[model samples]
Target: MDETVQKSCWGVTAKAVIGLAGVILLAWLVIGSESAAMIAQR
Candidate 1:
């Protein structure tokens, strides 16, 4: 029973980490695209 609870908590933590990483990657992509577009206008 305790092991099951631990596994659930670990899964949740892993999901949170993955979600945060995804958000960061998305933000980087958006910013990078914008910068590239701006440079192309020059």
Candidate 2:
């Protein structure tokens, strides 16, 4: 029982980490594109 609970907890943590990483990656891509556009305009 305890092992099952631990496993679920780890699964949740892993999911949260993956979600946060995805958000950061998306934000980085958006910012990079915006900067690239600005540079092109200049």
lDDT of each: 1.00, 1.00
Worst 10 residues of 2 by lDDT: 1-10
lDDT of 1 by residue, 1-42 (tens): 999999999999999999999999999999999999999999
Model 1 alpha-carbon drift over 4 Å, by segment: none
Over the stretch 1-42, how does candidate 2's per-residue lDDT look in tens digits?
999999999999999999999999999999999999999999
Q: Best TM-score goes to which candidate?
A: 2
Cα deviation of 20, candidate 2, in Å:
0.3
TM-score of each: 0.88, 0.97
Instruction: Write out the backbone clash pairs for model 2.
Output: none
Off by over 4 Å in 2: none
